[model samples]
Target: MSELRRFLEQLTAAPSAEALWDLHCSKMAEYGFDRIIYGFSHYMSETSMGDPEDFILLTNHDPSYMELFIGNGLYRDAPMVRWALHNVGACSWRFLWDEMARGALTEREKQIIAINQRHNVTAGYSISFKAITSRSKGAIALTAREGMTQAEADEIWAEHGSDIVLMNNVAHLKIVTLPHQSTGRSLTKRQREALEWVGDGKTTQDIAMLMGLTSATVEKHLRLARESLSVETTAQAVLKAAFQNQMFIVDGIQG
Candidate 1:
C-alpha cells in the first residue's frame, strides 16, 4: 500500500489526541516540516480565543520559544496567526516578507518576528481549517527545519501541498473526536461515571442504586464533577464533559 494510505488508516483509528498528534508530527517531518504547533478553541469570541485552559494545544516547538509565543500570548500579534484566523487554506511564509516590505507589520508584530528570527523559525506554512461553528477555530503552523530556505520550502510545497493540507484536515477532525484532557479540568473515574449517568437522564436516586452507593454519596460525586469541570450545575458538567469527549469514553479500549 502507499504511505499515504497507511497513514490515513492509522490516523482514522487513532484513539487519543496525543497519539494522533505523534503520528501527524512524524508524517509532516517526512516532508521537511520538523516542527509544528496546532491550536483549537471552541470558546472563541470576536475579541478573544476564550480561556487559555480551554484550548487544545499541541506542539513540538522548542520549549523556550513556546514559553514566549504561546505562554506569553505573543501569538495574538503573529502575522501568520492573524492570517489563519481569517482564511481557510494553506499559506506560505513568504507572505510575512511581503507584509514587511509594504511596512504593514506593527511594532508588536515586529517583536514576534524578531523572536522567530532568533529561533530560526524562518520558513514554514500555516493552515487554517474550515470552521464548523461560529465560535470555533483551528489552525496549524508547520516550520521547516533550521537551514532550509523559504525558496526550498516553497518548492516542496508546490509539489505536495495538497496532500499535506488533506492530512492535516483529517488529523484535526480526528483530534476533536478524541478526548482532550486539560489541566484542572479532568474528572475522576467516579466523577465521569456520575456525569455520564446524568447525561443519560439518571436521577440521583437512580445513580445511587446503580452504583451501589447512598444517594448522598452519589450527590457528592456529582458535585465534585461539577467542580472539576468548573461548572455550577450537573447539567452543565455533563455538556462540558461531552464537549471534551470525556463522557462515556472507554479508556483502555482505544489503547
Candidate 2:
C-alpha cells in the first residue's frame, strides 16, 4: 500500500502523456506485465466510440503490429477491447476465449486471436474504468511478459492484483488531467492568446484592440492558430485546443 501511494505521487508528476505512458510501462513491467495498451475515449455513444480523433491510444507494441491491429480496425473485434467497450472493471483474458466453446465469437475475432497468439500477446487482463460521463470511458490492457502461460500470469496477478489495480487506476486519473499533443498542435503564446480571446466571445476587431494589434495581425494569429490545430476556423481551433486541454490552463495544473 505504501508503494502504491508513492507510485501515485510519482505518477502525478509526469509532465506529459508520453511521460506517463513510459512510467506506466516500467511500473507494469515490475509485476511481470511487460506490455500495455491504454485508451481513453472522450466522445462515445451506445452505437459508436465517436471519432478516432477524440480518443487517446498509447501502446508499446511494435509499429508494424499496430499498423495491422489498430490501423486496420482489427481492434474492433479484439476480445479485450470489446469487453472494455461494454463493461467496467477488470477481467482476465482467459474469459475472452470462453466464448469460443460457446460459439459466441465471430470469425473475425478468431482471426484476431490467432494473430495475437503469433505475436505472443495471448495472456493479459483488461481493466475498464468507471465512466466519467455518459459518453466517456477509459481502459487498459496489461499483457504478461512473453513466454508466461496463463497459469503463470494468473499466479503473479493473484499476489499483486490489488496493488496493480490501484496503481493503474491512479495513473489513469492523473493522466487525464495532463495536457496532450492531440492533433499535434503547438500553439505559440500569441496564438493561444488569440484563441483565448475568441473563446471569450471576442471578434477579430475586439481582440486587435485588446491586444494592441492591427486587425490584420489579429486575423493572422487566428489563421495560424487554426492551422496549428488542424481546424478550418477560429472557433474550431478554440474548441480543439480546449479538447487537448491546452486552453485556459493555469500554470502548474500538474505537480
- Residue-level lDDT of model 2, residues 1-255, one tens digit each, is 687778888888888778888888999999888888888887688777766655777899888878888788787778778889888888888886788889999898999999999989999888999988787889998989898888887888799888889888988887778777655557877888889999999988999999999999999988988888777977778877776777777655422
Compose the digit string of candidate 1's lDDT tens values, residues 100-217. Answer: 9999999988889999999999999999999988999999999999999999999999999999999999998998888776654677889988888888889999999999999999
Query: What is the model-wide C-alpha lDDT for candidate 1?
Result: 0.89
TM-score of 1: 0.92
Candidate 1, residue 237: how far the Cα is off, in Å = 2.2
Cα RMSD (Å) per model? Answer: 1.8, 2.3
**Can you list the residue pairs that collide in candidate 1?**
none
lDDT of 1 at 215: 95
